[model samples]
Target chain A: MTSSGGLRGYFVRSENARGFSLLAPTLILLVLMMVIPIIMLVARSFWTQSGMIETADFSLVNYQMFFEKKIYLYVLGKSLLISGSVTFATLILAYPAAYFVAFRVKKNKLIWLILITVPFWTSYLLRVFAWKLMLGYNGVVNSGLIGIGIIDEPLGFLLHNVNAVVLTLAHAWAAFAILPIYVSLEKIDKSLLEAAADLGEGPIRSFLRVTLPLSMPGVIAASLLVFIPTVGDYVTPKLVGGSSGIMIGNLVTNMFGRGNNWPMGSAIAVMMMISITLVVCIYLWLISQVKKRSN
Target chain B: MTTVAIDIRGVSKVYNPGSNQAVQALDTVSLTINDNEFFTLLGPSGCGKTTLLRLIAGFEQVTGGEIMLFDEEIENLEPSQRPVNTVFQHYALFPHMTVAQNVAFGLERLKKPQAEIDATVERVLSLVKMKELGDRRPNQLSGGQQQRVALARALAPSPKVLLLDEPLSALDLKLRQNMREELKQLQRETGITFVFVTHDQEEALAMSDRIAVMSNGEVQQIGAPTDIYEHPVNRFVADFIGDTNFLDGEITSVNDDLVTCRVGSESLFEAANSGNHSVGDQVTLFLRPEKITLSAAGDASRQGRVANIVYLGNQAAYTVDMGDGIELTAQARPREDGNLPFATNDTISVDYSARALRVLAK
Candidate 1:
């Protein structure tokens, strides 16, 4: 049994090696692309930068500076608020569309789903600029409103604000939000809805009590997909957000690019990631506890 | 002295009306279910029994005609506004709610007090023998347990009528039999009219006080189980309910209460006159297996050879072939010594009374 061929058999016959080898390609790519970059960022966050060069010595001065200057904290809080609002708005808009496709459309639902993702086939930046064109003072919306005689002058409040960023980002992430919600809603048994109606609940009450609760997993997935990425988005704000609408992402970009405070930028990025993770975990825990209590 | 709980008058439902794919799911069906009566709609699949039940439940709108509950027209009312609850097929228990919540849902929607809701939920759960599992989810229960919860949920609201849409088809045979008895008892105890729908004739005969046999979206007969079993109106009903042997004949004489018919080419048999035939009319005679008796004596009514024998547990079925190629099936209980009256290939004679034969128009 101790032959030379046994060496080749070791990897082929071993269950653990087979499993590990199957996953090795993805694991290596993930380590190089994601894990290694994250580790380096975390390491660089603790280093201090002198002039234009980074020092090897570890210090907490960047965090101290962040605390001393209240703008970073305000900007972070504002970014979180903006992302939260965008998540809520996007879900509210996507839910009815997804529900219509999932329950009301009896034939060719795949076509509707494809139509929803048609915007994604184009470049995301192009769509964001398209939103800019629509929300501009002399854009289609203002012209249509003026042509309809509803307004005599173009509205200046339509662009370069937090509202513009929320609107644009919600439109940009519509496809992401709708698909998961659609999948979850599709998984619910239609008989359950009929049972609800037979139990004396009106359509509205049935929706609140049965339909909404059953489709929550999809809602949670959609929220996470939109919320996490939107929090760190810099382009949307840079194009639509003016001086008063500057967010934490803009400050981080300035620190890394023109400000040349790489360590401070890394520290802010790390803090933002940790805070987002903490909020998501707390939300998940809260939902679980709520479900337990109801049960 | 009971009033009608539900009266369906000329109800019809047509799906995709006026389109190329249109289908008539139901056609002008009429029924009147008395209060506290256990009524069943028995038919094969796609025969519109479930469609009629849904019409009563207001899940589907009838294309024509009115449905009245307790003499009040409810055909146009919404399901939530109607005074009826359904124990759906497959026991559609809400997956997210506990048993107590599922039971309390209807009562809560009716705006009952919290104390009353809790009390009714507990009481109904106990009625279905699911009191101990009130805190468990639907996914955590067995099929029978889930069915009980569904019944308890429907019964908790104390609706005027309960619609059961093949609620026991998912259970094993033993559980289904047990639930059948329990359901009859529950219906009697609660005094609520139950409209059960199933395709099983045996289940219908065992459970219903009165049954309506349907075929191709039309009601063939509606009467007591014995009445329907003893006297099916047409060939479809006669063939659908139980096994029967048919013999083609021509009526030679039609008297007051008796009709003499020439069977096949030579034999003669008299059937009780149903007043629907005349002299020289072509007719089909329906005879049940148990009614035809096999005797070995040569002096019997008609002579035949035993072609085959089927050994049933308590009875034996013999297929007798009379001369002139006439075949008849007769069933007989085994004697005390476990012996059949006649064996295969033995010579025997078959005879049946005049009342055992049913003559239907061809």
Candidate 2:
């Protein structure tokens, strides 16, 4: 009973103990929802899938299938390529927007931030469907082109391709890229720019030498945030991607839903996670190298 | 012939112009800083010294009049285009760059040869005695180290003039004093004009070849350190430079340069008249505390009882009530035994030379 009272005193006195207790509910929920599901998936990836009955017997057959199938390799590569382009496109679009909002817009900054995240309030599925309508045959772009007499016929190439997937994905993940980059840009000391200018660096050179390099952490974080989820995303591809834009996520979805191959789906998911972690690690290492070399 | 490095003519700056909240920061201020000279702009905070410095650096634009750098009009130029560099008060060293990179920044911006940039960066870093800490970032070093890096960075391009905006204000006393000596020596060695701004009068007096005393967006006086301290034209200049007692009185008799002033209702004191003042003219006389000598009892004419004694090392300040409600502060050196001579309520005689008690017009 004395020990129990002492433990209570420790809980009350120690900030770390109290902090962990405050985080306990969220931690337990994450363990149940995410960690246990990932563990189950790993276990299922090692099991054998025979026709309709997936057995508890551990084997490398599911992993072997991933290498043996050419379709899986093609789709996985295409998915990675699409996500990579999406990440690149979003960064290019987001940087200037974030810079403009951070440096140029002095007043009503909250309004600008609210505008960036406003798109999130609507349904993600609805937005993807909206992109489909915009990119589809006889859609806004096609009709507008026809009305302007710019093209003789509807551009079928706009839809049913990797272009549509990249476009939709880039648009969806834009705010994630912008907000972090904005925060980093805003955090930079304004006097550093003045000092650079005083040292004879013009506006363009100052931005490149001082502003660009300093905001790299935000750029890296935004890259990972967009790249990780987009690789496994299937909804935008399903709506606007049509036949050509189907990716690894589509295959995983198919194996789980119609194919009833949970073990195969689990294997593909695990492989995707592993490959992404490897890519992000290399990217982060390269960024750190660049930062150090510049210094 | 002394060439002028910066010739700021009738320049004025009114922040937020044409608005109700417009503040007149500088008003028709004209000053010429000579080349290779250590000139100081000395004033209290918000006294337009910084405004004048910024105008010369092209950081802020002038509402009227022109600024000439080395006899070339440069008021319209951008801060980057101007051939001047600033050592900001806070150092403003780039957090992302090492001390070497920061020092090399200006040379790199000028597109100098990499070899030349390396040599200049090395030279300037060593000049500030920061050669060993080149690889360390600004945050990694102490305040004084960062200050050296800032100075080295500003000097790397060999700017025609260096504008130091109270750079030593961040450091503690000992470091600040050491830096002040280094900076004065640096100016002499480099032969580049340095325009230093500070509120600390002692720093201005110690380092400047010429000091410009300013107040309320206008220059009060411009002269050598001794000229400013000894012969301040008005009450503000005398009070700002150092500690001085203001003895307000009316001139009873004028003797060309010397005037006998009736002070404290009954006492008459002789003072040097700066401006043309006739008999019966009201004048304010400024007497330096150190100029007045204090003794327990002597042939000194003015006698006063000590109201308060403040013990300062090497010197003690005594507030003396010189009869009839006239209180004046005076400083005296410690005795041969290293003890303060006067205590509270002790009557002491005050003696000051007629030349030391100069009068400024009312």
Candidate 3:
């Protein structure tokens, strides 16, 4: 193997093959975990299903049923709205925290970073459960409000709603949103801020013109990181989402479980994946356009 | 004399006061910068020149005393509220903006009309001779181009006072020389008071109308370049500005116009009185290297052996060691025949006029 001879020599001689070899492990894992499963799902969407098991036959009945049935589209739309709201809320909350950590809190920055991520040290399920305990009807918040005489009874509107799901998801991924934003904000050259001030801009205007624009990449990254996962998140909606709060993830789960409609479930999964990919592409394109226009 | 543009009265800066890490960066330094004049604060690093500039620009607050811009006190104003802009050393142009946009930034802040902003941007860009490349981003331009854009951006606002903090220090040697002349011309055309801070003595002397030489935390001297160069007030001012030879001596006699100082035991040098030193006081006489004349055969005032000769293109500097073991450098222009008048290890007599010497109190 040390000498350049035979197979080793051929490997070293071909530049394309060398690059392929370097990427082979990741390529194989992606094919196994992602590509193959997606292909199977797409293929299954075109097959016929009797109850749960999909028959190996070519049919478009699942897609046909999707257009005929209105519930799936409603759930998908609701899921999108919830995901977007969570992304927006998470970003709005994260930017200030990230900005403070990046610019204001100078000493012990590492400690602040660790503290920002301290909530993630616990299991995701545990964090959701903690939120469940706080926001439940008879939870700490209601009891505290009742004890203070601010509320006559435990508020029924606190949990098991779209707002509850959004609040929980936003809190859950707060660290994910903050970390990337903080990294990008921290990378900005400090002299740029001073230059803006010297050019007759006040602190607020300088931040809007320089700081926010420079940190857009981080905001985009954080937005995608939180939005993509929460769109298909099953656990949060399952625990907190009531009947009206059920999203597309619950629909897919039901189709795979008691509904026993594998083809329909596969069709919905494929459609959801396609829609997400389209949204992300459009989002990235818009960010690039904004950056170009500013430049 | 021009009217005072910016009056810095006994301003000082102390960082992190009441803490163990506290530092006094500037002492009670007072200076009056004239309108339409190119004023420079020249000093080495840690000499508080930059701190003073920052205080004037309102980037830093003075720990004590007042700063007046014309007739109003400006020490309490914010940086943006003050009518001064700085050209940073690194030319901190906005990396995400085009040259035109960067130049228009200040005008836009002032809410100037769109057409007026465009005209002003064009005028300043062309003033700096960067009219064609206004569409390029800062990163797309070269170092010199970026520097010009920085200058254009600062000048676009037409500020009352321009503060340049070692602006040309980042450029190459050839570019630095060209920019110095351009900067002086710009200052003249704009007729704005310019407060430039630099550590390069040559740059300060070449461009500034008046220079304030600083050391430690105090202003050592302030005068025109020629005054500061020919007649420095003290040893620090003389040593910091240019090449000089200091000969230790004591004032032997103080006449009406001249003070005679005795060097070692045999040599006595006479110079005009510095007005501060009297008879019998210890003093050091400063003489420029080029002012001393070297001869082979003459009964000159002083004599030394040529220990080493540095051959510059037009002139050669002879390191002459006197008989008393004191060393002095004398520069001699090459002869028209293209032959060196003296060589290394040759015994030469050195003579300098009394007017060329400056006696400073030790």
**Of the candidates shown, which would achieve the greatest DockQ relative to the real structure?**
2
Candidate 2 structure, TM-score to reference? 0.96
Question: Candidate 1 residues B1-362, lDDT tens each?
Answer: 88999998998999999999999999999989999999999999999999999988888999998899999999778988888999999888888899999999888877778999999999999999999999999999999999999999999989999999999999999999999999999999999999999998988999999999999999989999998899898888888898898888999999999999998678888999999788999999999998887777579867888899999979988888887768898897888888887788898878888888989878
Chain B alone: TM-score in each candidate?
0.95, 0.98, 0.96
Per-candidate TM-score against the hidden true structure = 0.94, 0.96, 0.94
Off by over 4 Å in 3: A1-28, A292-295, B262-268, B295-301, B334-341
Q: Write the per-residue lDDT of candidate 1 for residues A71-136, one digit (tens) a residue.
A: 988999999999999999999999999999999999999999999999999998899899888989
Clashing pairs in 2: none
Docking class of 2: medium
Candidate 2 lDDT by residue in tens digits, B1-362 = 99999998999999999999899999999999999999999999999999999888888899998899999999678899999999998988999889998998888866678998899888998999999999998989999999999999999889999999999999999999999999999999999999999999999999999999999999999999999999888889999999999988899998777899999788888998665788898888889998998887777888999999899898999999998667889998888999888888988899889988888877
Measured with C-alpha atoms, the lDDT of residue A228 in candidate 1 is: 94
Off-target runs (Cα >4 Å) in candidate 1 are A1-13, B253-257, B294-299, B302-318, B332-351
* DockQ class, candidate 1: medium
- Order the candidate numbers by TM-score, best to worst: 2, 3, 1
Best by lDDT: 2
Candidate 2 lDDT score at position B362: 76
- The C-alpha lDDT values of all candidates are 0.91, 0.92, 0.90
